[model samples]
Target: MAGRRRWSTEEILDAAAELLRTSDADSFSVRKLAAALGTDSSSLYRHFRSKTELLRAVADRILLAAMDDYSPEGDWKQRITSLALHVREAFGQQPQLASVWGRHASSGTGSRLVMEEVLQALSASGLPDEDIPARYHRIAVLLAALITSEARVSTVTPEEYEQGMELFRVAVLGADPERFPALSRFAREVRPLGVDRRAAFEEILAAQLAHIEDAVHPD
Candidate 1:
């Protein structure tokens, strides 16, 4: 029976994550997952206790994938930018799973590890030690928010996407031009430049870090 039966935590979480990729979390029930896994609901309880725990495991697995073998050496800005882009891609690849990630309180080991690595990278940028946590938190929150927001509007038709981008350009440029003069002047340049979202995110992050540095030690 041992040879014939096989249900590991990784397998279960992978299956659950795959389901989340295509369906809403509300629609993903333990019974349905067990049925799909060729096991009974009771069997799942042996591994995961509750549906919430199983979902947390699924989120952890996906988050780990986003952090696959990331290296910390080389340019700090580039590394962070790549990390953010990978995270964004991970979410885009699995919108439903991403939504679950954003909604959860982030109690999983994988999630915490990712945050630690991000904090370390930000700290290496020479910002105040006290500011690292808040800076890291801001970057993480922004990345997650942007990814979720994009996922929600991603169902637009190609033509509609183009039209929306055009409209966004006009709105950003026209709104409060006096206060956001630089943003207004660069609105058109911004859209096309985001083709490499990793670069864009990195640039934004670097700017934030620079701002923090200036605030802490102004010349």
Candidate 2:
């Protein structure tokens, strides 16, 4: 007998995470995952059914990890910040999965759990009952967009990152003073995104939460 099999869905996803962490982009496929597992790709098919299912499983794994690390008890700002940061941190570790997951705003297990907690936080923070869904969408979409953008660049090497920043600065400096006066004047201040890009990102996150709060609880 070839034996039952050693790998489960959990094992497959663990290997998937490894591939995602190591590569700039994992061109994911059942066959590749199987090879990585040292088992027949057909075995993966038995559990996952298709590549889409496999991707969703991997995504669930990623989100579940984020949720496990998340602290659910805190002020709305602190709690939301914690949740968003955990998700983004997981993306940083497995950047290639961002696209697979970015568009999926769903009510599945871990995702659903996080969404409910977020809605509760909004309600607790004084968002109107009818307005929470819209606000939640706004927050979720913003996080998805920002994290997707950052994750897409997660594998940029030190040299490429520096060169890209230099090119941006050069372009800014070259903007015509007459036609692009504001940019030309401010170009010197347009420095590269230095270490800790998340400092700026967290500002946006805070602003989003604050915007929601101010709308509901304006002074």
Candidate 3:
């Protein structure tokens, strides 16, 4: 009789995800995952052909978690903003997962579902059907980029991170006052305004979506 398989595919993938959450993606090797699960690497092969396939499954699971059942009702701007924020928060929770989501190209079912919901929401927002695909693509890219950038910043303590931002402000604003007068003035006015990354990202996303909306329906 064959020996019993000790771990299910879900158990293996869940272990891999836990590793991703606590460690960097580079550390997520099949050997490491198997070891963590108290199994040999060969056992993992029965469920996943290779580490790449396992990573893909992990990415799909993460992407599904990132999606929420967004309501199409409400001021379209608020609805869109809520959706963007939801994606941001979800990605923030799993920075490594965001990186995987950023490169997913296989038209996986979860990804397809996300795209469909986004397109549907855009369509309901009075955006032209023809423009939905490109708009959805842009929004996804922007949200992913913003979330990943914020996640990097979040790796540091709030106090240290604030000091770093202050340094960045000085560097950027000090470049040329005449050229960047508005930025200089704003920096002075908000001197050391703690990095509210979530708020900043929401504002940027809102503006971008507004632009897209205007383009599609041009006043």
RMSD of 2: 2.4
lDDT of each: 0.74, 0.79, 0.73
Off by over 4 Å in 1: 1-6, 155-207, 216-219
Clashes of 1: 0
Clashing pairs in 2: none
Off by over 4 Å in 2: 1-6, 24-26, 103-108, 193-196
**71-162 in candidate 2: lDDT tens per residue?**
78788888899898999898777778776677544335877877887888888888779998999989988988888888767768789888
Ranking by lDDT: 2, 1, 3
Question: If scored against the real structure, what TM-score would every candidate get?
Answer: 0.71, 0.87, 0.77
In candidate 3, what are the lDDT values of residues 1-219, reduced to their tens digit?
Answer: 977458988888789888877766566689999888877899899998877778778877765676644454576667667767666667777776666566543245666666766777787878767878888889878876787677766656678977888798777667576887877767555644336776788788988888977886788
Per-residue C-alpha lDDT of model 1 across residues 106-166, encoded as one tens digit per residue: 5777788778878877777777788788887887787777766666565346898788778
- Against the correct fold, how does model 2 do in TM-score? 0.87
